[model samples]
Target: MRTQTTPPAAPPVRATGRPGRALPLAAVLLAVFVVPMSISGTAVALPGIGADTQAGLAPLQWVVNAFNVAFACFTLVWGSVADIVGRVRAFAAGAAVYAVASAASALATDVLWLDGARALAGIGGAAIFSCGAAIIATAFDGPARARAFALFGTVAGVGVALGPSLAGLLVQGLGWRWVFAVHAAALLLVLLAVPAVAGAVPADGGSGARLDLPGSALFVVAMVLLTTAIVQGSQWGWVSPGVLGLFAAALAVLAVFAVVEDRREHPMLDLSVLRDRRFVGLCLVPVAASFGFVTLLSHLPSYLTAAAGRDTAAAGLIMLLLTAPVLICPMLAAKLVTRGIPALTLIHVSLGCLVVGDLALTLFSPDVKILAVALPMLVTGAGMGLSAGLVDGQALELIDPAKAGMAAGFLNTLRLGSEAIAVAVYGSALATALGTRVDNGIGDHAGASHADLVAARAAGGDLARAAELSGAVDTEGFVRFLARSYDSAFHTVLWGLAAVCAVLCAVIAVLLRGGSGRNSRPAPAGNSPGDRGV
Candidate 1:
């Protein structure tokens, strides 16, 4: 008998119609923009929302964090679900849900209602975001894919940069509720784009994988507990039972998740991915970079307005300087990357700039000009742009194409998880620092009050003498003292973040060999088995 030989399967066909090709990319970009914009845009309106609804600081924190926590927890599951079911279907469902949730938020009567709506929005956002890169991956190949990724990055950068300034305008012109209402309009655009894209792509015909139910539950529990502890720890005290219990629960659940995933045949996250030294190194950059980036973004607006005593609108405009670099740098970075510049180099450069930016801001005195404040922001933005795409690209490079969905899911999960932790951790740090400064100022004033009382008593308790003694007290001193104290506290937090950025840069330097060296290896025939088109 003759020996039989079999040919390899052909590469999967890519959809090519104009509507089919363009719609998914448009939908994904729009959806991505909405998520960050919604958070940043509404930030300017928080005081108004709080006063209107009589919500406390804790509730206000949840208004922002609920969406982040939900999105972070559900991202991987939804990404996997999109791969299993069909990307178009998943995208549509998420868009619809997000739209409704935005409307619900606009109409919310109380903090609980608004928070629930935000959580639902997060679920919807996860579904859309989880599949975003995969959709781009499937739609374009090679250089086209790189360009698409760059364009997507640019859109995200613009949205984030514009969100706060836009919100400030809206809050001044319309009302706080309109911020949520605007998202509803954006969602409608996504809804229209989804069907156009779905029509072009072939339906997902592969076997639907089992939902990682146990893993999903544990991940959600871990994230919620971790976020809760960070946000509430300052209020409740770090060692309070509520905070400690939450932290303990988060760790225990996460530990269980690792063991469960390691043993499962169809794990949500492939543990082997972590073993890739190069990939692991790239991942750490995002964790550290995000922590530092968020620390600046979260606190800078308040610093500009309150510490600098600028008008809110002026502060919002100053924030634009920070965002402008995010928009501009990615296009430049993409060109450099394609010219065979190492991704690791870009990562290091970005982190280094972040450190410099944070240090600059920390050294900002009350007399520092707005331009001085804006300079650090520009440096930070460039760093962010350089590091933004490294994690996803590196993760995809390590895994087989068949496991692209899972890898994408895991990468997003890590990114979102890092973001959530960054916000919580940095927010706690700022709050603690500010509180201590305020307390010390109040303590120093106690003696001044005591001296005034003694002077009044020595005057035989005459009302005129008491008034004269009170007038003699240095009231302006207290105002200046409070301002100086706040400045010191703000600087302390920025310096701490600068230290974080330095550590991150060091870690990336140690772990990542130059991408240029890796690219010099000969290209494989056809697509590399591990390479997805995007």
Candidate 2:
């Protein structure tokens, strides 16, 4: 009998040169954008949603933070699962889940239900987000990959920039539910496209690898405790024993996680990656970007509505000027990179723009025109667009192809972690400053007649009220003092952000070490091994 011989399976074909791959890639990019857009867009609609549902401040905060916390915690797990289960299937599952959750959110009767739905959306978001770049990495190479990433980055930037504006429109026209309903529609589009793009890439064979469940558990505990402490410290009092206890627990859990990961095979995160200077820089770039980005996003609306005295709709519109360039800049940067501009140079320039933007806002006065505020915001958005993809691309470039999933997970984890910290810290700072100004103003009027104090208190100690009491007990000086105090507090926060941005820019510039000019050559092409993963 003739010996039967079976041909060995051919290597998995890359989609880089496939016809119409760009269309699917665009769909994938859209899916990624939906996650961030959903979160940011809902922010402007929060007050309206709360009022409609009769939710309190705590619940309102959860409506936003629940998604963020879940997304941050599960990012690595989802990435690892994608590597084991197959990227296409994992991504498709995420889309389906996200769509379901979004639909449920629209019908939610209570704040708790809405928050639960949002948390579910975050789980699905993690699955899609973790695998997004990996799909792009596998499907494109060289200059094509660079451009694809640029497009992807641009889409993300636009989604973020447009989120509040979209929310404003939706709330004005149909109500807040449409903000979520729209995502459900978008998720359906992604679901239909996944099969066409993924082709025959088999499920990953690493499912049997140890998952480091203990380490993951410990990490979750630590992150939760730490984030809660930071977020609640201002409201609860920083020195409160409860806050201190949570911090202590966070440290303990962190220590345990480190110990467990050190001993585990197939650690959820390969700590060894941190030793690479390039990787460290790449990770920090995004962290810094998130710090600056969240600070602006969280506080800008408040500034517009409260200090600038704009209505919700107008405030949302003004905020768009800051975000619009975020969408546009990535495409421009992609073109620049195709011409051989170094990623590091792009990052430095972006950081510089952030510094400049923050500084402008710090110096802004009540007399400043809306255009002046809008201009700085545009600059900031442009900077974010240029920097976002450059860091992701650079980070992937520094890692092995097999480790791309893990590396991406780590980067995302750091990004979200930075954002959480930024929101908590900056929110605390702004609240503290506002409180201090109000308290000082009240104390200065202590010698005023009982009637004046009663009147001031009833008016919420507003600046205008303080001015009204000017004659009650030599109150003109008190009014000027309070006005100056408010101005100082406002500038202090703005200038603080600017200073932070400046420091980040200086560090990145030194580490990146390149001039701003674009290179003339495109990235190398073909089935080049060096171009495989990043």
Candidate 3:
């Protein structure tokens, strides 16, 4: 008689061969980290920039949107270029461009100059992000690949989580300019390290790769017009000809792109990716998650300042409760994936937790303790952690490895585009909620318009200014009314968005039940489970 025990599974092998193995990963992380850092940090510095430049709300909004618009429009183009020109070259060049732009931005005295610099920075960011993902994908495999992606994703989250707090310190210690200045210095270091760390890879440009100029033009025009309409809708009137026209133009351009892409021999955006439902589900993950995260980033700091009576730094610290999970959770999720747990299951659970977290936040009132305000954010943060690299990992898994850069670009486009729309949609929702309250509470209030109320809110609900515009008899009474109305709007939007996330989770859960599609299992480069992307 012999007693036999099964041996433990062997650890997955790591990919090797490069100028320096760790250099590629470091460059990727640096690129990923800086983009989100710049985006999120800028959010914190908006007030400071406004104070310094004496810019109005419209100009300040442009300062933020300029970066987004450029990032959204050109990311795909850069991704394609990365594949053709070589990842390292594209990445290093992008970092240099970003550094120069950051330096210029730091010196900007006027809002227009700052906005232009930010837009240039966004183009550079697009290059870094698109190439960075491809470099990581090509540089690693199996469990190591998962870990690399996890770290990459974690750094992105960490950048966002740390951005506000870090920016607060820089703005407080030095000035708003120092925020961009520090970024410039860091990027310069990345540039100097690039040559030594990034090994050469042959350009894949000879693969009959043709740039889809028409497709690119159409998409850029659509995105620019659509984003402009959404961002300005609350102030400009949603039904105004300008807003309506922009929407129409965007839709028409998108339709043309669809037709052009479908017919093109070498399409910029391969429509084939959309055939897989699971792949589409994975793409939606970032979009849905961002709606919650970006919404908070846009509003929570202001809420903490005006509603909770906290300073900028303290507000950012409080936000750590919501963002800290991002720092640690992705690695944990990767571990779970390595242990044979389904990534989709984790994703569903993550969204469920997010829904719960948002619902919990609705319980918060002006009188609620700080601890109460911070606790629910932990739940949302946890949800974010459990689903860290899931979206990007799954997305890469779905596409051709050679098109890694384009896949990354496409995925990010969806995420960033959703964020742009979410900001506007959320703003509109808040406006609607406030309007309902105003109509009911102060009927026929002189000079009261939806635009005025929203503008008042943008000004942190200044009672005196609102009173001056609306001709309210009692400034204090109006202030209190506005505060309550804003609070209600905040809760309503969160709850509504949470419900939407929950629905998305449900759909994904059903799609993933029993077994995930072909790419369900994580495997090394040579041993991928199936060619059919899940």
Q: What TM-score does each of the candidates earn? A: 0.85, 0.84, 0.88
| Candidate 3 lDDT for residue 471 | 60
Model 1, C-alpha of 384: deviation from truth (Å): 0.7
Model 2 residue 42 CA deviation in Å:
1.9
Model 3 segments more than 4 A misplaced: 1-14, 200-208, 308-314, 371-375, 443-455, 458-475, 510-534
In order, what is each prediction's RMSD in angstroms?
7.5, 6.8, 7.5
Give the range of the ten consecutive residues with the poorest summed lDDT in model 1. Answer: 454-463
**lDDT of each prediction vs. the true structure?**
0.69, 0.70, 0.74
Instruction: Identify the candidate with maximal lDDT.
Output: 3
Question: Which model, 1 or 3, shows the larger TM-score?
Answer: 3
Worst lDDT 10-window in candidate 3: 1-10
**How well is each residue in 50-88 modelled by candidate 1, as lDDT tens digits?**
988999878887888788878877877777677667776
lDDT of 2 by residue, 1-534 (tens): 122222332332354444557567767888988988886787777888898899998988888878887788777776666666666667788889889999998888899999999989988887777778766655665666676777777777777777777788999899989989999999988888877657523333335565667877877778778877876786686779999999999999888887777666666666667766667766777766776666787667655544555576787777778777777788788778766676676777788888787777765564568876777888877777787765676676666555666677778878777887777777666656755665555556646434434333322325546555544355666555554555566677777777776776666666555433222244544444324433
Sorting all predicted structures by lDDT, with the top scorer first, yields 3, 2, 1
Rank the candidate models, highest TM-score first: 3, 1, 2
Instruction: Report the Cα lDDT for candidate 2.
Output: 0.70
* Residue 485 C-alpha lDDT in model 2: 55
